[model samples]
Target: MDIGAIAAAVMLAVSVRKRLDVFDGPADITTSLMMVGPLLVLGWLVAIALFGGYREDVFGVGTDEYKRVFNASLVTAGMLGIGCYLAKFQLSRGFFLLAFVVGIPLLLMGRLLLRSAIHRARRQGRLQYRVLIAGSPAHVDEVAAVLRREPWLGYHVAGALVPAAHLAEETASGIPIVGTTEHSTALVSTEDADVIFFAGGALSSASQLRTIVWELEKAEVQVVVAPSVTDVSGERIKVRPVGGLPLMHIDPPRATDAARWGKRLFDIVAAAFLIVAFTPLMAYAALRVRLHDGGPVFFNQVRTGRDGEHFGCLKFRTMVVDAEARLAELHAQIGFEAGLFKMKEDPRITPPGRWLRRFSLDELPQLFNVLRGDMSLVGPRPPLPREVAGYESDMMRRLRVRPGMTGLWQVSGRSDLSWSEAVRLDLYYVDNWSMLQDLSILGRTFGAVFGSRGAY
Candidate 1:
């Protein structure tokens, strides 16, 4: 669809600008060449398809995939440019350039609109892929857990196929255990599975896997492999084939000096701009807090910043003056977890605090923290001293960059997310840190705040 849209737009632009003037002169070979234009458009479309632009995952999501589409389109245009020059065709190069620039954006906009509809359908459970797992009970459970976690991935686990050889008998994960692995392909056919995920832990031979792949292909379900590897970032892995055996290379995690410099520059620029823009909002919020609570407006608390450094983080005070003194008594309160504190219906909050917390007005004062260099405009969510002190090895990596007022946790689901999901999102941000990514997150932060689904 993207290619067709781009091609039609480009061809129309070219046809108009060139003004062929067909009735003025005798027809020539150039006319015939130009008349064969639809064929050229079809060729370009096929080139993009062959380059993987039409794949299911890339079809309707992610800037990364759209970037690929742009690259493929450019490659196709470059090839056409070479052919046009070789044939001495009387094509308007200026029109072609204009079309290339205009059409790509139009194509992307079309895809974006389509993706919004697709996302809505997925949310309503109208469009989803039915998948089945084949492995031992433990591996089956792991697969089911992952599927449940990412509902946006649009996978419904139909069942699990646990073989007696791998397990003692047919055992179940939370999802149904339909049958043994021996009849897995038949089960998939009967259940109408769209995908078959071979979860790790089954001791099936390569020959058996090959046979299963062949059989499942006949059933017309996509096959996917689940390696036992965990906590590995996709960017760190490379596949190299040597002597027909695929070798997986896991590069060591190394934060180099250049990347650090780039990150620091980004933090400085983003923080400075945010502080400048939010200054008036911060002052208004502080005045409201002070007028409402009849106390100091600023809430200052020591939080672990980058590399375990302590910094006084700022927020508009939403609680009473003696809220901290009352903390011990409220510690016994149920529904809120320790370390990661929450007081959804606390008595200490001022009357105005409820509205402030709902829209995240309390976080406006953190712009000062950003300006003071204690925090970034976007990074991991700043951890409380207690949370930082209890860090597992992986959690400490989040502190490599300055903490932020809003981050993965803020944009993901805020206070509503589970501890594990929060950590996973933070880790994902840390591993995939980029200036473009930070800007995208900051843009998304507004939508999350206004939605107010999880702020309180």
Candidate 2:
């Protein structure tokens, strides 16, 4: 994929340079490109390999792979430019810039698409690694649940080797208990495992753990340790070696960055652009809502925002005028939730409202809230005032940033999510959000909206 992207970039650069020959002095670009492209691609691959971008452990998850690719491409471009300058080769300054400027993104995109393919394959039970978990039964269950939650990680939990004292027939998360942790090596062989995860209570002492590792080394099985810590992003956690022991250093949450000028500027600009782009759609939604039983075109409800402030969250009317008045009737059907209240078949939703909600056209009015400083393009889901009132101490974390028009809760199953899971995701976003993560979520939003998997 990297080779293809680099080749395409070279060809594009050559064609672009030819078109700009009026000022760039590159009448015949193809001949030069043909001579230089392969060499550049070879060097680029070598650089990426040297940078550990192709490491197996970095695959299947995280942004580390993408970062390494970006770093490697930049370094390759630097080396090429320096080599050309030192050898007095006219590498066509415009061509040099265009190739890398185009190439790096293409390389990143290729990796992204490749990861999507790999995830799909893994989800279908292909390209999987047989896993042997070593931990206490409780800890084993925790590890298994995470793996189950994201099958695309490609770990097939064969069974668990728990502490002898805590042996059980199966983990609560449904992973069968195979043996005690003392026999991890034997079980790895018997189970034909490719990876062994050491969770809490995996070993009695450091020496015992060392012995197990040494025994497993001969089998060529990968070893991973899952600390009790969970929900921390890779960016916030750093490993520091002290006295031959590795200690994890977790940086403080960057939720305050949500209030920074850069993110605010990005929200303003992106929200404005989206509003303009979707004006026709928004207008149509408004007209349909207004024509439906003579109800108002927009629905505004008081929702809790950053710092527990109440703001009027705007949405195209997705229910009848007396929707709130009828909420008491369906409270029994939905179990009267505290955090997020939703129903698959809410009787109050109007006919047009159903269509608007499915594609998220109903929330189009919230883009104006984004422009009005009441919401953001992406952040935690806006909680109702009643929901905020019942929030536990931990749940209040979502109020640290402005409520979002669309958020992790929106993209990750939306109304289909349980209240606890939705709160967990929102808190995770509040703790770990970055501009890059926001962009990634925005990209995924299109798919989620179009697919309408969880929307009512």
Pairs of residues clashing in candidate 1: none
Candidate 1 lDDT, tens digit per residue, 161-263?
Answer: 8876654444454567788877877888899999988887553677787888888666678988787766555556788999877788986653232147676
Those runs of model 1 whose alpha carbons end farther than 4 Å from true positions after fitting are 1-47, 60-64, 76-98, 165-173, 254-259, 335-337
Please provide TM-scores, in order, for all candidate models, with all chains considered together. 0.84, 0.96
Query: What C-alpha lDDT, on a 0 to 100 scale, does residue 85 get in candidate 1?
Result: 88
Best by TM-score: 2
What is candidate 2's TM-score against the reference? 0.96
Candidate 1: lDDT over CA atoms? Answer: 0.75
How far does residue 177 in candidate 1 sit from its true spot (Å)?
1.4
RMSD of each: 4.9, 1.6
